[model samples]
Target: MVTDTRLYRKVTAQAWDRLDSRPARRTAWLGYDGSLPVIAGTVICLVVQKLPGGGGNKPVEAS
Candidate 1:
């Protein structure tokens, strides 16, 4: 059995070269701003939580 050392080294080098080549993505919190959309969502959730039934308002059906 003949082992190709040159090919093995080339493949190893290629793999290492791609280790940090991915485009870095900024985290959600880091890229997000204090905008109206965020504020609106928060307010909506708060309002929902403040509802009479504490959230779900489905009427119970009598059997």
Candidate 2:
């Protein structure tokens, strides 16, 4: 469980790192596929996007 959580966080953080190095645009999408903590081997999806005129305030969605 702990390993899964760490891996999930690592994947998410890597996505954010890549996004941060890019130039700002009208829109952008970032997604992560990883395991969940409580559900053991079960996986989940996390998506985030930069909204129009958000000026860097991106919104995140997790499933």
Model 1 misplaced stretches (Cα beyond 4 Å):
1-53
Candidate 1 residue pairs that clash: none
Off by over 4 Å in 2: 1-37, 40-54
| Residue 42 displacement (Å), model 2 | 9.3
lDDT of 2 at 38: 30
- TM-score of each model, in listed order: 0.14, 0.16
C-alpha RMSD by candidate, in order: 26.0, 17.9
> How far out, in Å, is residue 4 in model 2?
30
Clashing pairs in 2: none
Q: List model 2 lDDT by residue over 20-59, tens digit each.
A: 2322432333342343223223233443243234454444
